[model samples]
Every structure is written in C-alpha cells, then in structure tokens.
Target: MTYDLYIGDRMFSSWSLRGWLMFERFGIPARTQPVGLYSGTMKQDLEPLAPARLVPVMRTPEGTVIGDTLAMAETLAERHPDAGFWPVDPEARALARWLVAEMHSGFTALRGDCPMQLHSGYTDFTPSDAVCADLARIEELWSLARTRHGPEGPWLFGAYSLADVFYAPVAARIAGYGLPVGDRAAAYVARHLADPAFRRWRALGLTKSYDPMPYAMAVTHGPWPGPAPRKARAVDTGPSENTACPFSGKPVADFLELDGRVFGFCNPACRDKTVNDPEAWPAFMALL
Candidate 1:
C-alpha cells in the first residue's frame, strides 16, 4: 500500500528531510504532499491530519497517521522488515538507535544557531561556545560508530541506515553554515551532499523561491562545496534561453554559458554565484 508523506519546504525544513529520507533511501513507495511551512499555511495544511501540528507527518494506507520522526522511523521499520532500516548486527543496531534518539532529543544549540539551508555556504558565520560543544559531541558519536561498525563504507554503520537519514540535516547544517568540523565529519557531510537523492531534493527545492529568503544572514555567502560544476564558457550576448531567473523568477538581467547553452539570472549576483559554482545550485545544473 502506498503511503502519503507530508513535507515542508525542502530548503529549510530539517525534520521534513529526515522523514522523507526514511522512505526515499529505502525504496519505499510513497507520495508526498507539501505543507506550507514558511507561507504561514502549515496549520491549515495539517488540518486533515488533526492533532499532528507539524510538517513531515505521514499517513499509512490504512489511514493511520504518524507525526513524530522517531515514531515514523519505528513504524516504517516495523512495516518493512526487509528494508534494512537498521543495522543487521545487534550491537550496531543498538548504537544506531542511540544516535538517532540523541539526534531527536539533544543538540539544541547547533540546531538553533545553524538551521539547515541548501542554498550556499556562509563564509563569516562563527559558532558560539555551545555550538562548538555540540559539534564535538556529534563528532565523538560519529567516530565511535565508524570505528566500531563502519569499517567498510562511508556511512556511519558501513551501509546506510536510519542514523544517516536522521543526520542528513546535520550534514546540511555543517555545509550550509561552513561550521568548523573535523576532517572525518567534514567528509561525512560531503558524502551526504554528493548523494543523488540529496541532490534531487535540493534541486526541487531550488525550483521555488521565497519572497524574503529564510535564514537570511548578513554574513558573506560563498559557493557550496560538493560536486564540481562543468567548465563554463563566457558569453557576450544576453540570456539566450529562459527569460526568468531560476532563483527569483524575475526577468533575466544577466547570463552565463555552461557546456554550450547560455542560462539567465535575475541579477549579476545570481549570475556570478552560479558562475562561481554551477553545480551548487542544482536548478542551474538541471538547466545545463
């Protein structure tokens, strides 16, 4: 039976990403419904699933509604016994559960100071003492998982599991905010960024633009680190293709060519940002 998953904007909703990955990474069949988190329609959007006042709520085929991410994880694991949502080894599985539970209930400082944003990296943002402590704790947990259980693969438990799903947003936060992390932690974050599923989610998120960008920072934003963009060729002419900016949907005022086709942007800032790194903005990558 097909499940209905309700999610918020992909760009900023950390919890929503975790919920989606629970099904998406495991190949579970489900259809997604968007809840208006930033548009102030979240309450109305969640009205059908009464008592669940948050995004990333799921509805089972039998009409059972699940709200909390932890509950959703347990329910999915129970329903799909063959999905391998947890590690096969009992000890590893126990550690995985511990990681996910800690992620669910702790790390308030990092979560509050650095919200997940799939847009670009902040160059000047500095983490407070509490955030630094949280990062240290996260790295410690990651190291333990990798040393004991993840001897084979890039994932924490060798193969991907619910631990990775839950931490995906944490990875996004590390990348998006340019948080100072250990090399190992940085590599794990990079792995998440390079995942095709994560890329697709970020690409779809880029298709929609916010009026006032969420998590707007006064600090300088640099190009995001991940897959490198194709070498672009400078174009003398104006936009040769789309008339509207992929980011803001405004009229095209600037242009850059990648591979061969010229793409347009609403302003020089958008154009230059894309030019600096095209693949960072997956919507632009789609255009190329």
Candidate 2:
C-alpha cells in the first residue's frame, strides 16, 4: 500500500524536501514522482492531481488526493500512529504542532531572500533588517521548543518530529546563505545538515541538471561547509581554478558536464544560458 508522492526539483524545492522527510524519516514507504518545476511543466504535471497546483502533492494508498504540507502531515500521522510522526507526550506534541504551524505561515523575508539552495553557501551576503528579524523569531521558536524538551536529545521535543521536518529546509537556507544565527540555531542547522536523510536527498538532487538556477544570488561567500558525502560523489565538485565561468565569473569547480567535456558555471542558471544558446557562449564553444 505504497502512497504516491509528487515533488519538484529536489535541489531547489524546499517544501518538497519537507514533504518527503515526513514520510522518509518516519519509515512510511512512498513512491515519488518528480514534477517538472524548472522545466515550465509544473502546471501540466499537476493535472493528474487537480486542484493541487504545487509540488509535494500526495495521493494516499486509498487514492485520496492531498495537497498542502500541513494536511499531508496530519493525514500521514493519523494513518501511521505507530510510526511516531508526532511526539509521545501530549505537551510536546502540542508544542511541535505550534512550531510546525509557525514555520508554515511565517518567515516570509528569509524565504524570499534565501530560498533553500543546497548547491552552495553565499559568502558575506548581508541580510536586510527584515531578514534579521525573521531569523530572530525562528531562533526564539527553536529555543522555546528545545528548552522545554531538548534535554533528552539534539532534536526539538527530545525526539524527531514534524517540527524538525518542517524547519529542515529553513535550517538549510540559514546554513546555505551563511546567515547570522545564534549558537543554538547554528547547532540546529548543523544537526540538520548531518542527517543522513538530508544528505541523501541533496545527493540525489544534484544528479540532475538545472536550467536557469532558481534564486541565483550575487557575491557568494563560498561553498557551503562540509565535504561532499560519499553518496553524492557524482554531483560533488572539486576545488576552483584560476579560470571562472565566463557567464557568471564563478570558480571553475562549479561546472556542468555536457557531452565529453565540462563547462564552468556560477550556477545552474548560467549553465543553462550556455546550453540554450551555445553559439553565443564562446567560453563553452572553446571547450569543444
């Protein structure tokens, strides 16, 4: 009785990752279908699940269509009570729900500026006042949850819950953008990064090519911390060289492989530029 899960590009789709984790972390087996998020087929791809015009849409084993992460989370939790999707304690469960709801509704500024990009971290990208305020609120929410229930473990509520799953992408954005966050927040981000499931999600996403990278930022600080996990070797990059991608002037390490040769790009967007119009790109042309 495997459920069908529809998601977008794993690398850039933050909510998609959140939906996937709700199932993966809890041992709920699901079959995933990748909807074309960047390929401009998102609307067409979602026709099968009408009224669900977004990624992370799901169809239950009984063929009930569910949209939105919150509804999906609740349905999954109800169906698999033994899986422990929520915390055991009543208080902790309520708090977890609060945190997840807040995350779903709040943090507009942070999401706008730093969309979850596991590709690399931005260097010295300063946050606006609004963004800082959002980060502080997030820290406050995380701290409250931890103070009440984290004595037992690294996760909020003392054990992994939907709260962690919901905020996982926010943590990724914070780490990816090198945003200023408190030690507790940083630790939380580190924990999320170290999760095997997250690493696998990122690794699998990197295997695909991105055309017109989403939310390409200027003035990148550097690649996000941590060496590429062994599983993501196929997508992991090497050190940068003196030469840069002509399109975005990013280091050589962030290159795309096409044909038998490699082409340097600052981000997938830049790479797609070359791919779409090879004659216009001398740098890529020279590689031939």
Candidate 3:
C-alpha cells in the first residue's frame, strides 16, 4: 500500500527532508503532496489532516494520519521491520534512537541561526557561540555512533538508518552556511552531499526559483558543495542517443539538450523534471 506524504518546500523544509528520507531511503512507496509553506496556504492545505499543522505529515495507507516525524519513524519501523530503519544491533539501535530524539528536540540554536538551504553555500556566514555549542554536541553524537557501529560504512550505523535521515538537513546546514567543523564531521557532511538521493532532492529543489529567497542573508554566496547539475535546454528534435525513454521505456515525446547532447522523455512532466537538473536522474545519467 502506498502512503500519502504531505510536505513543504524541499529547499527550506528541514523536517520535510527527514520525513521524506524515512520513506525514500527505506524503499517505502509514498505519494508526496506539497503544502504551500511560504505561499500562506499551509493551514488550508493541511486542513484535511486536521491538527497536523506542520509540514511532513504522513497519511498511512490505512487512512491514519501521523503528524510528528518521530511518530512516523516509529510507526513505519513497526510496520516494516525488515526495512532496517533502525540498526540491527540492540546497542547500536538504542544509540540511534537517542540521536534521532536529540535531533528532534535539541539543536535549536543551530536550527535557528542556520536554516537549511540547498541552492548555494554562504561564504561569509558566521556561527554564534550557541550555534558552535550545538555543533559540538552534534559532532560528539555523530562521532560516538560512527566509531561504535559505523566503522565500515559512511553512515552513522554502517548503513543508512533513521539517524542519517534525521541529520541529512544538519549536513545541509553545515555545508550551506560554511559552518566550521572538524575533518571527521566535514567528511560526514561531504558524504551526505555525495549521496544520490540527497543530490536528487537538491536538484529538484533548484528547479523552482524564489523571489527574495527564503532565509536570505547578506553574506556572499558560492557554488554548492557538490557536483554541479548539467544545464538543460529544450530542443525541437528527438533524442540524439536513446530511442526510448530512460524511465518508462516509452516512445519519446519531449526532448531536452544538455552539454550539446539531446535526451528524450515519454512526457512533458518527465522532460521538465530532467530539464531542470539533468544529473539528478541516475537512469538519464547512465545514458551518458
């Protein structure tokens, strides 16, 4: 059964990222709906899921509405035990839970000072003493998790878990604001930036442009901290490479040009998604 996930703008909604990662990383099927967080339609949009006045609300397949990210995580874990949302080892699992809880309840200073934004990095941004303290606590928890259970893999538990899902936006905050972190912490942030899912999310977010962009700061901006997306342009001709759509194997209906190469999609929707960020799609990238 597919779930209905209500979320806000991907570029600025930190909690939405956590909720999305819980489903996306775990292979859960969810149909996501956008709530206008900035356009002032959030209340009306979320009215159907009454009392859930926040972004990242989840409506289960059975018609149960869940509001909080923690509740959603636990419910999904209970429903899909084999998905490995939590660590397999009992001790590691406990630590992961603690980390997720802390992330949900703490880190107010960092969250307030450095709102998550994926478009570009701020070169001139500076962290306050409170923000620094929050970063230190985060590093301590991350270090403990990685050293104890994630010695092999790049994730906190040696594999993707709820901890990584919860902290994905924190990584974005560190990278976007150019927050000072130790080598180990910096490397962890780099890992998140390099992740395919994370890249795709950021790419999708970049598709929409904001006027007077949310969380706008006077600081100088630089290129995002990861691989840049290929610029896509529309062309009247069909794909120069593949005859079939990369996603559905359907006949090409729309075309996009990237780096002097043309790509065909089954529909305008698919074409538009790729045109905004050609590198986000693994299937399309594999064609190169």
Of 1 and 3, the candidate ranking higher by TM-score: 3
State the lDDT of candidate 1 residue by residue for 152-175, as single tens digits: 669999999999999999999988
TM-score of 2: 0.79
Per-residue CA lDDT of candidate 2, range 206-255, in tens? Answer: 66766667777777557666334321111245442326777556665455
TM-score of each: 0.82, 0.79, 0.94
User: Model 1, which residues run further than 4 Å from truth?
Assistant: 229-288
True lDDT of residue 232, candidate 2: 10
| Candidate number with greatest lDDT | 3
Tell me model 2's lDDT, rounded to 2 decimals. Answer: 0.80
Model 3: runs farther than 4 Å from truth?
236-240, 248-250
Residues 1-288 of candidate 3: C-alpha lDDT, one tens digit per residue: 789999999899999999988888899999999999999999999999998999899999999999999999999999999999999999999999999999999999999999999989899998999999999999999999999999886999999999999999999999999999999999999999988788777766766789979999999999898766678887888746878999899999889988888888888767776786777788988988
C-alpha lDDT score of every prediction, in listed order: 0.88, 0.80, 0.90
Q: Which whole-number lDDT from 0 to 100 does residue 258 have in model 2?
A: 49
The CA lDDT at 46 in model 1 is: 96
Best model number under TM-score: 3
